[model samples]
Target: MWQDFGDYILSEAGDDPVKIAEIGVGKFDKISEILSEKKNITVLKTDIHPKDSTVIKDDVTNPNLELYKDVDIIYSIRPPSELQPHLINLAEKINSQLIIKPLTNEDLNTGRVKMKLKNYKKASFYILR
Candidate 1:
């Protein structure tokens, strides 16, 4: 899904300096490490229970946009269903893109976020501006 996410972002925004906000980073350093391969990207990793180095420790359903304005991409791996619309709203606000990897069998239609999926499955939902 991360690879798919990288492809989606590149296809939409290319190699520009992208501001990426990722939720549920938890203790996985690999995400940041892999994304670091992209030289022009800035990653802000977040979680409900963040360590000291985590940035923007806020809930995804109501993100602190004042701290996260102008982001170029919003990424999440199976965030709570209620937070999905907020992700879409943030992307729309910043004119960015959204990449979400949902758990198997999870539904993508909440009807709150209006999006046209480039590709979608029970396991993933990929969107672009």
Candidate 2:
């Protein structure tokens, strides 16, 4: 499933040099690690309580717009329900594609914005563009 998620992002990148950001990246780095290895993709990991120097400190509710400037894609893996809407807001503000991999069967709290549910191989997630 993880590989599927990474592949989906890679497909979206499509050989283009694209900037991607991972929000609420607490302790998980697998997807970021995979994306970082690709020559065409630049990955940024952010968390409100960064566990290490590699994870930048940024609150999703009030994200630093500068950090997301020119970012082509923004994805969050299992972000808390309360923060999902904020993620959508940030993505819209930055005009970047948004992907949210929420917990299994967890309903999104996106309000009026409807995100499409996607199943890419074994990975299941929601996408908003």
Top TM-score model: 2
Error of 1 at 92 (Å): 2.5
> Pairs clashing in candidate 1?
none
Q: Which candidate is the best by lDDT?
A: 2
lDDT of 2 by residue, 1-129 (tens): 999999998888888899999999989899999899889898999999999999999998888999999999999999998999899899999999999999999999999999999999999999998
The regions of model 1 sitting more than 4 angstroms off are: 10-13, 119-124
Model 2, residue pairs in steric clash: none
Candidate 1: Cα lDDT at 104: 65
What is the C-alpha lDDT profile of model 1 across 1-129, one tens digit per residue? 656555555555467787777877766545565676787887888777786675558776676777577777777777677777777776777777677766666777446565555562222464645
TM-score of each: 0.75, 0.98
Model 2 spans with C-alpha error above 4 angstroms: none
Candidate 1's displacement at residue 15, Å, is 2.2
